[model samples]
Target: MLLPSLYFEEGFKVIGNMVNTAFGKFNLTGKTALITGAAGLLGQQHASALLEIGATVVLTDISAEALGAACTALSCESTASRILTRVMDVSRAESITTVAEEFSDRRIDILVNNAAIDPKVNGDAGIQETSRLENFPLVQWELQLAVGLTGAFLCSQVFGSAMASDGRGGVILNIASDLSVFSPDQRLYRKEGLPADLQPVKPVTYSVIKAGLVGLTRYLATYWAEQGVRANALSPGGVFNGQGDEFVTRLTSLIPLGRMAKADEYQSVVQFLCTDASAYLNGQNIVMDGGRSVW
Candidate 1:
């Protein structure tokens, strides 16, 4: 039985299209996440987690090199095709808009605002007892705010506004510091080589910026409540990769749990905030300290 050439060609095309559609629907599918600061530790972890659970992750970072490196690493994985990379300055409106447009419908399902910079601290030991506030340099404050608070607002306002209009009620998770929730009580704080004035007062422009993030999340949540968009903050405790024994000992002691938090310890908490598991959890700051702030 000879079949017509045109019929054979059409049948082949139909089969191919079915396979492609099935693969698209079944492959780590369901929602796209736009992760800002995607090169940082927490940002990488967050993106990887989402990828693990079947997400199309759009990555953005201030550094093209770092972002390229991360995207390269993710691409090597079997699921690498799910990752998208872009250079974005979260503090800038135009940058976010440019990236947002890359998504097919201008509807991003998730936004992770995880960009921040800790200000450079310069001071001498036991200077709190002697230094004056007026002597600290002003440049440090400017740098800190530029990266931390200003950047967060830029992403939130733009990404958040888009999400509000998208109608799916997307989720926003702002990475904040546990220090934002409760002030760190590191006793006998000392930094050598810092100016006397910069030493005595708490120069937590980083933490203060994070504190502002909490309020931002809440206010956005309230305004967008009717819109399907939810916003929340996840404040992590001091993440110590390898502080010296003395530094770790001094800092961990203040933590009632007696140890600094490991990086992966934050995974579960962060995943919760970013997932459907926390569908009703909105406008709240979840602190991931090991009981340090409470103590």
Candidate 2:
């Protein structure tokens, strides 16, 4: 015999509530995520990932014009309410502090440290010579570290401290590079007839900064574990931006997948790392290098 009408209604409601709760673990509704360098290519993708999962995003960059353009690009009728933009120079403590204070009334549940100086190497003889490790300028090295490494530290210190004390906990994701785990294959950047002294090499600071981020990830992971905050690093491989076919072929040959990642390929992984979907994942560097690092 069938259950009474009231009993069936109650049972169906209970099952629906349970389903919602289970799926809600991946939902980030009402949470706010602040992304540094949000005007850059990967930064925009990271913001999109969080927005797709229902988090309000604060897009910050050093250039107000670029930040405004990025904000406008991401804004739509549906997502307009969820997007905010701020000008933040991650290298300066005061800039970070100012933004932190501006949003003091709201809780920031996630922080994506995606700022870095990635100097592109081209066939230009002058650029190639200056990029040589021996000739690399002191000023360039310092500036790179200030943005890539020290910036992550300062953001974590200010925003992460707040996350720890707020009692709600949070996520801090450091956007590192596959170079963090492996040295750059300098051969991929060698020009056909470049002299030994003129061959372009990836700057030493890139590897150092990326590696440092992973170290910071481990420190913060445990530093705030008791406080409920989690920290992790994402080590992404090269994306397929328009580059010389020769360079692309050389780079892809090293990868087991034989192809570079699309610009948007990392979005789902970003969502996972920044949401409850990765609740048990902390102190880890998740490398997405298309098997190149392993090979």
The best candidate in terms of TM-score? 2
* Residue-level error in angstroms, candidate 2, position 181: 0.3
Instruction: Give the per-residue lDDT of model 1 (tens digit) for 223-255.
Output: 888998889998888788776676678878778
- Model 1 residue 75 distance off true place after TM-score fit, in angstroms: 3.9
- For model 1, the superposed segments whose C-alpha errors exceed 4 Å read 1-28, 76-78, 104-106, 120-136, 186-188, 191-202
Clash count, predicted structure 1? 3
- Model 1 lDDT on a 0 to 1 scale: 0.75
- Report how far off residue 51 is in candidate 2 (Å): 0.4
Residues 80-199, model 2: lDDT tens digits: 889999999999999999999999999999999999999898746764487888999999999999999999999999999999997889999999999999998899889877788888
What TM-score would you give candidate 2 relative to the actual structure? 0.92
CA RMSD per model (angstroms): 10.9, 4.0
- Model 1 earns a TM-score of 0.80
TM-score, every prediction: 0.80, 0.92
